[model samples]
Target: MWKKPLKPVTKKAVKTKLILLYEDIVCDGTEGCKRHKLVGKKYFGGLYEGSERNEDLWLEVQQYIYDNYDTEYLKNVYIAGDGAPWSVAGCRVLEKSKFVLDKYHLGKYIYKATTHLDDSQQAAKEFIYGAINERDFDGVMRLLQKCYASTDQEYKKKEVTECARYIKNNWLGIMVRIDDGGAVWGCSAEGHISHVLSARESSRPMGWSKKGVDWISHLRVLTRNEQKIIDLMEYQDKKQRKKNRIECEDQLIQDVQKRKSSRNEEVLRKAIPGLEKKQFSWMRSIINAGGIIA
Candidate 1:
């Protein structure tokens, strides 16, 4: 899962989108791992779009897992992420869940730590990765120290120190990868975020209102879950019609008793025309929510 930022409609606006995704991987549990992609469930949200708090969101994540899998029988559930607090929170929410520092982020820090090495950077990364693979925390720190000492630049030294601290803080997650061996594949959360959220929400040069962000994020999740957009619109139309009918029932009865032709009754006779009229500005807004409308 990633907290992807959205383009604000106004200069003063600050909006963010959080996408939670979980997929089941069936690995052979062998040294030579082979796996295939499976359907995954996704949840999307904006910071202020709903009444749910951060804790509430995580509890819902727990519930999502429970609803999908048999938690009692599952031996290991790995939560791989970029060491963000929200990403790591899954460990606390889920039973038997282990946090694994994602390869993308771990590589990022290692790259920063070795940036001053120039020609020898790749060699240094190899050694650092080797140390991680061997579950040697001290060896990893020693290599980072070497990178630090090799550089006279204060900025490079800071980068090296920061990398060291990041590794130290996420040491347990790194160890989980080492201990799990080939059974665990590195995290693809970034790619998932790009595909699910960023491609529609932020990849373009456009601005979004908070409600637009919320609606499209949800629509994207539904699309990912194999729900057709047309079908969704139809369902929403039905729901709206049902609500309108309930709200108008008493008024319609009063109008009938008075022998009056009710406008509410006329509206109830008609289907939602938003789908039929292509010129409706609001209909265009809904269709273009994800920037897919042409």
Candidate 2:
């Protein structure tokens, strides 16, 4: 979530807040074995498949949070993902949110878009690439439209039309990054999912139950926040001090796990009810994870 104030803030009170919405596919690399041929040698390996539900789940959670929480803080929210329907669905559902095409995904689109370009179209493709990289979305659209008008091949024209539609639909959100002087090309959600979820999936080949994945993913989010780490450490220290300063290894481990699994807002609400103070300033840092400060 991102927000721009309806009015200018007074000198005494100025704040910038961003909320990052994230979700991941729940798919193990292998789903039942099938035949494969490598170097003329036939062997059986499980089929690798990824879930299409991640985007749906993410949108659902986003709607749930928006329905329940105070989201007026969001000024210029950005929803980014690869070229998955779920990602697109999330963007559609959160129409107010800026829908940014992930840079990597855009590159793939560009590659396909330029495959059959002639010399003139090749130059146009170069122009399009330059505009995209420079965040000149209008320039890109213009170039695309020009190509679409000139292309004779039905398939090529159709590709241009589709790309144009995608660009036009996401134009506003993509343009917002430039107007705000913020980084917009990359996706942090991809990194978050890879680091938190994919790592676990790779390590635990058996695949995770939905609940288990959710629990671990939530724990990973908490652990990644420095303030959460400090709070957990403090909580553990206080608990240890209360228990006659004796460290019971098993109990300590269980307590630490519990802390990691707990929600930050819930924990803070309990620890300092009605305090009206924000404990996790680190959230701001997380939002700027892959962004340039200026």
Top candidate when judged by TM-score against the true structure: 1
Model 1 TM-score? Answer: 0.67
User: What TM-score, computed on C-alpha atoms, does each candidate reach?
Assistant: 0.67, 0.39
- lDDT of candidate 1 over 12-129, digit per residue (tens): 5555546455565556456676754544656655453333455566676678778888888878767777787766776777678788888788889999999888899999999999
List model 2 lDDT by residue over 43-75, tens digit each: 111111133444445455467657755677645
lDDT of each: 0.74, 0.52
Clashes of 1: 0
Q: In model 2, what are the clashing residue pairs, if there are any?
A: 1-19, 2-74, 2-75, 2-76, 3-74, 3-75, 4-75
Worst 10 residues of 2 by lDDT: 40-49
